[model samples]
Target: MLNMNRPNDVEAYIARAEADAVKIPGLENVRPRGIASAGVIGGGTMGRGIATALLCAEIPVTLIERDPATLERAIAEITSIIERNVTTRRMSADEAARAIKHLTTANEIEALEKSDLVIEAAYETMAVKQDIFSRLDRIARKGAILASNTSYLDVLEIASSTSRPQDVLGMHFFSPAHIMKLLEVVRTSATAPDALATAISVGLRIGKKPVVAGNAYGFIGNRMLAIRRHEAEAIILEGVTPDRVDQVVENFGFRMGPFRMGDLAGLDLGWTRDTSTGATVRERLCEAGRRGQKTGKGFFDYDDQRKPVVSPEAMDIIAGLAADKGIARREWSDDSILDRMVLPMIDEAAKILAEGIAARESDIDVVWLHGYNWPRHTGGPMHYARTLGLDTICARLKAMGRTPSDQLRKLLAAPQERQ
Candidate 1:
């Protein structure tokens, strides 16, 4: 049975949880290079957060932008953040002044020549990131650590743009980087031990929880998220409403459901108006200018104060898709809703573990708990699965006519091999 007690059970659970993290060979022996100064390319929201984090850790930062206006805007944003912290008592007056003192802004890539570590937090495209890495290869000081803040791009391909592939790694920070505690230290095949060490050390210095990830598309969290997204959309097509789905997930302890999250993040993230057709609900919504919360409309409509309510327009689109696809509609109970949504995530996590993309099952759990806001009371998805009994989950997957991944099957076949 699962232990769900508080305080009394917390310490023992934490001990077992920590033991679940897998250790990479030779990780302990590598001594990380000291970071005296850092460089952050791009002055967007993500770049500003990276620069602010370095400054807060007492490491000086040289932030580079493509033009003078953008550079100034980033500088102003950083300043405003510091001032707000002071006003809110998150930082004292003197501390805020000192943090500002350690920051410098530049418009040229060459200005980062002396930095010990330079991170590219530019646009999330191969062309843009490769161009930045190529420039850094020639300008950055010899032996400098080069990193990318890409959330989904290939780290190896980015490293190939630079001559020192061994020194290149991915330091993927969750959005709003300064506040988020999770830092995915993505290691490529050629990543030197010391490079990984430096990334881990820097993460720790900045008060972040660091987990090592292999060089795979979307790494751990995003890969599983893709599966969950597909399943969410599939169930909607079958009969479930967005509100019902959102409520079920929220009751399970998530901060928000997928549809609400999509609205808040904006449905227009990758959607281009010119290329959009009314084939899919999201595409149709974007085509109709129902982008997201910023526009006061999306899967849910917002009030004057921005509280969300169900939208008739969105329901109409969903109905249209259901009619076109000829999917049967039925009443979806909360249990079925929860199963359809979360089971795929567990399956994908199993595949990731089997493929060696994640070092441990708990590491995947950590990514979801901190980055994706999986409920802490549930002790992460993997632990929760164990609580449900792995055999029971496997049986349900089979009963649903789903083919379990090889790793999951093996794990089920061997009782002692379970994490």
Candidate 2:
């Protein structure tokens, strides 16, 4: 151990000196940049970008796609991304060319057999991921790490499908993985501590800030979005137009309003109920084919500049639907809407911490700041809550006639009960 003799406060100094030894289970032993060449399975937007990120780090990448046509498309997408990087001066022409050359494409799974690390960016389906991992388990070289770039689903379940659970972990990269800086590293119970350490180092090498998360459904960011969506539903049901909701929150700190975000991210993403929350207005919107921007309509219509304008038709629909459901309308008080959206987000943030899904409030905050475009000025969702006082946030929810989920309620009451 390094000397702990240099401080005024004995315990504090000793603890400071031991920081490197204080890592969680899978992260206790790790070194940066181990097994070089990375493998990216699935050539979709996320996969191609991940491959590019690895290449930018000077790590050769083997990007695998099942379809010959999609393989060609993935190559083109990688080329486009590299060109953008070149034009922006983030990379030079020669470096870009070298990176592209280092990127090898394959329609064959066995190509990944040579990679020291492989991230499966395949479809969201559990079975699909299971099939991919089953193949990787047999072919991946010994000691090679296998990771999943799953956005929400349980990483543990995906890791369980692989032969070596210890080397299988979640490497949740944000969309357009090369540009987004957050990479959530998830460790299952069976994950090897050293492997987790390795994953963090890998994240750093590829220019990402990896926040280690405990395994759970939806992990951190997307899981909390449930609370946001719920409040959006309540407000819309309370006679607020989708456009109004989007505008309010967008100004509140979000880069885009939730509904507009829904459109941009594709309403179909939330429409397909992996689990049912009962039929709601959102379902109706989906049925009507009013998926956000790509359809030229969602909560609002987009112009040539992609600047959204209030949709006459969506307003008409919102009013009609409210009337049909006997939901009343009112001139929305802006603070009320802000409280409704943010308080629950705060509550969920607290519960996520209470459940050990996140390592710290900073981890949760960084995820939002980097991946979700949550305002960096606010320091992240949890940090914003801490600054506001959890008790105050919880009370705000109560005053709005909102019933926070049980987890949040327990979280809020626990401290009071403890004190």
Candidate 3:
């Protein structure tokens, strides 16, 4: 059994797991393609970050934005990033100059024609991505890899838009891509071994901790996160204050809790003004312009420094929503709140493993540890669950009116010696 009490043991396990994450079983012998030059489509936050990462890696980059105004803005923002790096001494003045030389801005897809790899960080809609890929099919070089930085859209469906599905994949970078370390290199059913290998190579070249994930809804980290968010929202509706819930999670070692993270990421993400109704807490929040820290309010209010304070207005909104839906309010212990928030995510990880969305349980842990800021000392959700014992987890989940996943049941039924 693993020893959670020893800090050294936990650190060693994480070290080993991170090393193992890059090794895809079947692609062991496949050589990664050289990325000589790259192209990035879109000039939004994600696109600019990706371009910055590429430039910092000393790769020649052509950043394509079809709109003249947006393209101009992207160039300015990327220049500011380079200037900041120099000011912070992260990059020397000479290095910043070279990075500027390496960057090229264009207003057309055809600019990517000679690039070795092209990534589309366009808007996150099926139609928009499909359109981009269809254009890339004719524009990008024959053997050049095509990737989508889509968070949740189907990469396989996106790949189908091209004649070369083998050359297509997903490079799901976290927000603030230039700084975040994790990259989910998603491989579709038709992605070639070398294609996958090449993407992994590029991820490493840009100083990211890359993990191979099978294409699925939300892939690894976000898939499990969806469950945690659902449970977090449910508890608040059941009468736990958002602050109390966030505090419980923070005490459990997360950098920030779900509501706080939502607030930071903006509650209005993917929410539309045209179609929004007060059907859910999030929708109501958006409706009220409590769109998050950007607007200075969400589940919690933010001051000038962006520090959060409990908002009576938000609490009243939550209470009203619960009452409207006829949900009974109840008192909750911190332990209960933690269990409800975390256990469902553990169950979702089981489903991810059983469905081969992740190659190993350790890979899932790596995703959480690097991608989602899962506490390092506890290893990760899976490692923490194992330390808690599968029996205990199943019992808790069952008591909460949830069925244990078949994967968890199998692990439970396995002989103790084998387990």
User: Which candidate number maximizes TM-score?
Assistant: 3
Q: Evaluate model 3: give its TM-score.
A: 0.95
What is the Cα-based lDDT of residue 369 in candidate 3?
89
User: Residue 171's C-alpha lDDT in candidate 1?
Assistant: 94
- Colliding pairs, model 2: 26-193
Tens digits of per-residue lDDT, candidate 3, 223-251, equal 99989988988889998999999999999
Compute each candidate's TM-score over C-alphas: 0.93, 0.87, 0.95
**RMSD per model, one decimal:** 2.4, 6.1, 2.0
* Candidate 3 lDDT: 0.90
lDDT of 1 at 201: 88
Sequence-dependent TM-score of model 1: 0.93
Residue 10, candidate 1: C-alpha displacement in angstroms: 5.1
CA displacement after TM-score superposition, residue 42 of candidate 3 (Å):
1.5
The parts of candidate 1 lying over 4 Å away from their true place are 1-23, 67-69, 274-278, 412-419
| Alpha-carbon lDDT, every model | 0.84, 0.77, 0.90
lDDT (tens digit, per residue) of candidate 2 on 233-337 = 778878787777877888877878888788788777745655534357666666667777888877788887777888877777666677778888777788888
